[model samples]
Target: TVNELRRQRKLMEKLSMEDHLTGLPNRRAFFDCAERQVEFSKRKSEAMALLYLDLNDFKGVNDTLGHDVGDELLKSVGKRLSTVCRKSDLIARMGGDEFVYVLPSTGKKGSREAETRIHQAFEDPFSVKGRSLKLTASVGIAVFPDDGKTIRELLIVADEKMYENKEKLSRESKRVTIT
Candidate 1:
């Protein structure tokens, strides 16, 4: 009976830290790990990068294609990100159509390279429910010690940058359309 209780507890803990849809670490898990990483970076005098990624036009996908297809798209996105990231990197789903990545011992240059790879990963269409769907994400990167000292502070900076990036992309698309 005790062993069974322990197993249940372990499963609960795992479920608590995981996103049900994508099976990636959830927001709670990301924050917990990120806090530790930030402290480690501070103690070791190492640089770290926080990337906030928000899918562009994700709501449209759900609206047009249905939730099942949208869910498949999110899972595919997670798999792509996992492939792109290193073992040392921490990638998590931060709720609907949003993900966050923590790159330990990485600076601005490394973050930019990671961003490029992420964009490249999305270049190909995602096949879900026999339909090929195109998607892109707005990525915002913040380097530790340069951007913020705490995880929450870094997230705030990264979120703001993500919005800025999204706006920039919107403007660029509008310009292209106008031309």
Candidate 2:
């Protein structure tokens, strides 16, 4: 029993920075690493970027289906997001259908490409419990030094931008519905 407990504890440590549900880095893990990266950028005078993302209509799925389905959807989204990012980039799930990407040594052009890739990743349908569901993610981007000097400030700006993007998406969705 002691050995098993130890093993479990080690596993948790390895995964401690990640969300157990989606297998994406948790906020703690993301921010810890991101802060270091920001400091490095500051020291080196290199560029960096932060991307904030949120799933639209995710709550509707959870309400219409169940938590199990909702969780599966989140996992799929996480996987797709990972596929979109570069090997050097960091993708983390902040919590509850929200995710972020930390782009180190990246410029505005690179950040734009990353954002576009992430958006394209969600273009396909997600299959859950034999059902094909469509979803979209709103992305907010903040460039390093250009947007803010520190990780905390960058994140705050990114989050604000994310909400603005989400609002745009909502308006588009409503327009389509009305049409």
Candidate 3:
């Protein structure tokens, strides 16, 4: 009886920690790990990076292809992100088309490398329901101490930068159209 109960508890704990769709860490689990990592980094005086990524034109996919296809795309994106990110790093879906990456002990070079890897991961088309769809993401990066001392502050800055990057892209596309 004790062993059975222990197994059930473990199952519940794992379920609580993972995203139902992507099987990646959920926001709660991610935040817990991120906070611990931040504290550790603070103690070691090491730099870390947090990246906020938003899928570009994700709403359009849902609008045109429907929710099923959108869900598939999201799952595929999550899988690819996991592959590109360091094994020690944590990638979590913050719901919808937004994802967060916690890169521990990552400096400027590692951050750029992670960014490049993430970009490259999306270069290949994702196949869903016998259809291949191209996708892109707007990424905002924040380094600890430089951007924020705390995880919450880092998230805020990263979110702002992500939106700013998306806005810049929008402006550039508009300029091209006007020209």
TM-score, per-candidate, Cα-based: 0.95, 0.91, 0.93
Question: Model 1: per-residue lDDT, tens digit, 136-173?
Answer: 88999999999999999999999999999999988776
- 59, model 1: CA deviation in Å? 0.5
lDDT tens per residue, model 3, 1-179: 99999999999999999999999999989899999999999999999999999988888788888999889989999999999887889999989999999999997778878888898998778888878888778888999978999999999999999899889877765210100
Ranking by TM-score: 1, 3, 2
Worst 10 residues of 3 by lDDT: 170-179
Error of 2 at 121 (Å): 0.3
Residue-by-residue lDDT tens digits, candidate 2, 68-152:
9889989988888888888889999999989999998998999999999987887778888877878888889999999999998
**lDDT of predicted model 2:** 0.88
**Candidates' C-alpha lDDT:** 0.91, 0.88, 0.88
Residue 117, candidate 1: alpha-carbon lDDT: 93
Best by lDDT: 1
lDDT of 1: 0.91
